[model samples]
Target: MSEKQEHASAYWKENLKYLIILLTIWFVVSFGCGILFREALNEIRLGGFKLGFWFAQQGSIYVFVILIFVYVRLMNKLDKKYGFDE
Candidate 1:
């Protein structure tokens, strides 16, 4: 294979690893903590909001938005690195 193709393949492999890790964290925090462990977290409160309630209502959504932006930024960087930027 050509050097360019090899580099692109390697870049994609690395990017996929990062994406998987980030997505796993997102899932765990939003689903695990917010839903599964919600009762355990209910004992804590912050700024008039119960921890579990906040996570279920607003925190997860906020995290999802941040994750979207993070994905966009990472993909943009990946595109540039792989000469796929438009």
Candidate 2:
């Protein structure tokens, strides 16, 4: 491949890697904590609510928002590394 094509490919690969990682985190927090590990997590309390319940109702959304910021930060760094930043 040409030099530019190689860089483009690498950038895309890195982006996909971050996407997969973030999605995995989302799934774990939303589904694992909310359903699979609910019983265990319920033993803990968060603001008078069970941890699992909180995760199901609110934590997942919070995590998603946090993930958005995380993704933006990561992409900024990635863009700089790849000379794609404005």
lDDT by residue (tens digit), candidate 1, 1-86: 99988998898897998789879878988998799989988899978878998898888888888988988898898889788899
For model 1, give the 10-residue run with minimal summed lDDT: 17-26
| Cα lDDT over the full model 2 | 0.98
Which candidate tops lDDT? 2
Residue 56, candidate 2: C-alpha displacement in angstroms: 0.3
Clashing residue pairs for model 1: none
- For residues 1-86, write the lDDT of model 2, one tens digit per residue: 89999999999999999999999999999999999999999999999999999999999999999999999999999999999999
Q: Which ten residues in a row have the lowest lDDT in candidate 2?
A: 52-61
For each candidate in turn, the TM-score is 0.79, 0.97
lDDT of prediction 1: 0.87
The per-prediction CA RMSD against the true structure, in angstroms, equals 1.9, 0.5
In model 1, the runs with Cα more than 4 Å from the true position are none
Clashes of 2: 0
lDDT of 1 at 84: 87
